[model samples]
Target: MYQIIVGIDEDEAHAKLCAEEVVGMPGDGSEKHVTLIHSFTDNPSGASATQLAPVREASDVLDEAGIDYDVTESSGDPAEAIIDAADDVDADLIVIGGRKRSPAGKALFGSVTQTVILNAGRPVMVTGVPEDA
Candidate 1:
């Protein structure tokens, strides 16, 4: 069975899209296990409702697909948390979402997607937010 880790945050639409892509992959749900990860920089309990939205959205998508999965909440840098989770689970693949960003914006605020893509030992699948999304 392939173990997959999906990184999610406040962008619910992008997160759900990532989950959907994984579900659409060639394989029965039983043969692919999914882990949805949400990383928080501070106390998870202090997170506002908005911060948890993506996790909920992604969970709903996986649930509707009848995909076996679990949710993980970690406190630290988002990219590091996601990579650590993958290592803990021995994930075969990582699915993450990205959004269009200006070069200046990317340079100023390093991208978690980019970090994971570079550091993840396993294959990484990246999904992008639709232009209108």
Candidate 2:
């Protein structure tokens, strides 16, 4: 079984898409190990419903797929957290969900997806917002 790290954020739809992609990857019908990671910049008393929504959605997909998985929450830069999680788990692949961004917006705020893609040190699969989404 392969170890995969899936980076999920506030977008539940995108998160589900990422999880679906992970579950659909070619395998020998054996359960794969997955680590679902959610990164936050601020220290909240606890995870708000909105913050937990994506995790729950992704977890549901994994559960239905019979995939072995765990959830991790980290406090720091999103990209750094994802990369760190992958490193900690020795993940074979990393899946990240992202949205369409304008060039100026990306340049102004930087992009976690881009940063992770550039520095993950492993294979990365990026899922984008669906056209109908």
Candidate 3:
């Protein structure tokens, strides 16, 4: 049995699509448990509240899929929190939504996805956001 963990940013549309992909995966749903995770970066200026929208959207997706999952919120660097959660759960796989960025943009602001890909012990599945979403 595999424990699948999906990282959701709280974007309802993006999260809905991600949950659909998870549920629609070619496997027995009974053999897997999906866990949804959300991380908030510690912004001294209090930027964490901005994450509610995406997290809510992600939760809606799980609800619609009828996949019982756990949603957690944490305050810290996003990469660290996500990695910690994956480790705590001993997840077999991780799914995350990413926004594509140019090389310059990536260099200027390193992506959490990239960091997780490098450091996470489990497989990571990254989904890209559609232009319209």
Model 1 stretches astray by more than 4 angstroms? 43-51
Error of 2 at 76 (Å): 1.2
* Candidate 1 lDDT over residue span 1-133, tens digit each: 9999999877878888999998899988788899888887767368743358788888888889888998887777999989999999999999999989998898899999989999988899999884567
Best by lDDT: 2
Local lDDT at 82 for model 3: 79
Each model's TM-score?
0.90, 0.92, 0.82
Error of 3 at 75 (Å): 0.8
Write the residue-wise lDDT of candidate 2 on 76-114 in tens digits: 798999999999989999999887999999999999999
Better model by TM-score, 1 or 2?
Answer: 2
Over 4 Å off, model 2: 48-51
Report the lDDT tens digits of candidate 3 across residue range 1-133: 6777777664666676677778877776566677777776544655443256766666666667666776776776777777888898898888887886898998899988888899998898887785686
Model 2 poorest 10 in a row by lDDT? 42-51
TM-score result, candidate 3: 0.82
Compared with the true structure, all predictions reach lDDT values of 0.87, 0.88, 0.74
